[model samples]
Target: MPNLQDVILYESKHQEKDFVQPHSHQTHQILYVLDGQGRCQLNEHTSPLKPDSMIVIPPHTEHSILAASKMTVLILEFSHLHVDADTREFLIKPVFKETKVWSLNLFVSSEIRQLLRKMLYEQSQESIEYKLGIKLLLSQLLFILMRTNQSMAQLDSNTLRSSWLKEYIDSNFYQITSIEEMAGKMGISSRYMNQMFTEVYDQTPMRYLTEVRLTRVKKMLTETDLDIVTICFEVGFESLSTFYRVFKKQVGVPPNRYRTTYVGMSDE
Candidate 1:
């Protein structure tokens, strides 16, 4: 959807006192810290950089990074055409129009780390379809960042209730009975909480909880030899029929088939 161009993606490690002089890029630049600490000087403002933190520099913005300790960072630079008008306005324009930096929560940090690593692998391989792979991955990365920004915006007037909701779901997805119940625990109306959560997460609370369960289902299917029905209830699915149906729809295969295929691949 992004149709990104002139892409440059790479990793950098800096020792203490290392500095990157003030510079500007014609393309939007994203710097994500993988380890250690630093400080980013953006125009007249400065922001701290620690592990799992990211800074998004809008096109032509003056910025520099100074490492206060050993640091590893992934840098991605790209420009895009208006091929997807909706993406430009909703995802790219709003999120990247200004220099912004934020620390990622554990769930988002893990996901973004995996995506960035895949992009690095694609860049290194330079395979025939690497360009396409990079474009898709970059688009996904941007979408995740956009949702994260939306969640942060929800708490700008108060506290990060959306983040709290996500963390709670991540930790207790298997035991979560209903969104209304969860909302009640948070001292909010189910309707209101669902609206706020969906606005920030781009999905309803139930959908997010389902996704978390499915992610666990996938891992257990590949890594363990548990029976499908057992795994289903373990992951908190109430009905075998529903589990099979939803697993097939979301994963494109039934649980047994997925396990079989993955096991065969691992053996090979």
Candidate 2:
């Protein structure tokens, strides 16, 4: 049950002659750069503002702006009251943090730019129901921004988890015996770990683990004089027959033959 209050719009053109001294306001500001380039100073940090760059400035945050060239900016300012608890905690709080500037590229699509333009037009009109139209547009825009942010966050988190899992396999391949054990260490189910591995690496977790073991076996075969059984055990293979089968299938040769071929090449 959020209420929007004091909705105002400002479309301004600025050049080298214009300057805004440091200031703050009580209402949240959504500023979009329509054209040209500029620089915004929010407290101690300065960010370059280009066409289609949108910024959300929180309440009572000191900020200033200077035009690097001729610039046109469309700013929407408003305050909200009685926002739902979850929305306030997640979407609103993050954007309104004093130390953070919520910025996104509005020029990612022509549709987005058109939507903002429509909102601006509605805001400028004094016709019947224009206020309602502006409010609806603003709500839609906020929804899009929140959804985009959530999607990007999820992608980043998945990427980080994938990287950590790969590093774990790389470092612990010698001791890892099964996919379940690896997944257990990470406190996730084997099936979910496999799914993550498949999505990120295009292979199942157990398959990737086997690949890691086989890669080490090949390295040992080429670089060291270790016997086939010793190399197999060192690479965490519990069964000689299974190791030989996998090695022949994946490397197209038995372990001894692979070592011999590598040795012959080095000698030649």
Candidate 3:
């Protein structure tokens, strides 16, 4: 039950040449660079700041940031979170090790970026039980960062490649035409890429891509007024027959009938 105390989270956008005077906080601070370029000085050492860079500054560590180009940073300040001894020993301690600043690869960075966005949204909405929500989200964020740090050493190059491939298909499945095109973009053979991807994710890239597209199609069918033909093409099916056949096979009902049944249930 790790609980954050006195949390303060905000984003600072700086214009070129802008700088923050040296300052220290009584609470631990996490600085995440979202956009642009800068340099962060912690004590006497400095590190370049670019998109996906992260810094964890312990309380009382004097630090400053200088923007070489326009920059956007998310700053999170909080007191030492009360946590179970086991969590503090393993996951928490390693994250704030001697290395105060580092960069995350694209896949891990994307996950962190999404969590940060959700935290920002929660902070903005301030709905009921928002503090609790933020605390849970913070825990999730820390767990992810810790696991990412651990996995960096254990993951092989092929594993990393597979992770990146999965992330790409997840984000761009609707626009992807073929596995060969994706393999070319990654500069790897389709056969090898497919083998590695399947090894890591337990499915071929095309199967994963279809799963992603159909997931979106289901959401649109139930929540939106878009017709089946439009939904099919919108989700990259290329034609209604193919979309309908796959949708019915996977979902066990035609798209229209599924939507009619589910949406009607929701109204009751």
Candidate 2, backbone clash total: 0
**TM-score of candidate 3 relative to the true fold:** 0.54
Clash pairs, candidate 1, are none
Error of 1 at 265 (Å): 73
lDDT for each residue of candidate 1 in 1-268, tens digit (9 for 90 to 100): 2335546688899999899999887778899998999899999799999999999998889999999999999888888562267777878887797787888899999999999989989888978988888888888888999998887776663247878888999999878888778999889998888887887788888899999999999888888888998999998898999999999999999989899888646455
Judged by whole-model lDDT over C-alpha atoms, candidate 1 comes out at 0.85
The number of clashing residue pairs in each candidate reads 0, 0, 0
Q: What does candidate 2 score on TM?
A: 0.76
The sequence of per-residue lDDT tens digits that candidate 3 reaches over residues 35-90 is 99999998889999999899988777899999999999999776656444665677
Which residue pairs of candidate 2 clash?
none
1 versus 3: better lDDT goes to: 1
Instruction: Give candidates' CA RMSD values in order.
Output: 16.2, 4.4, 16.6
> Of the candidates shown, which would achieve the greatest TM-score relative to the real structure?
2
Ranking by TM-score: 2, 1, 3
Q: Residue-wise lDDT of candidate 2 within 1-268, one digit each (tens)? A: 1235646677889996467788987777878788888788888799888887777788788888888889998887777652445655766665555533345544443555676788778867888888778766666666676676676577677677878899998888878888789888888888887777778889876787789999889888888888888998898888999999999999998989888778646445
Model 3 regions more than 4 Å off: 1-4, 82-87, 153-268
* Cα lDDT for residue 183, candidate 3: 98
TM-score preference between candidates 1 and 2, better one:
2
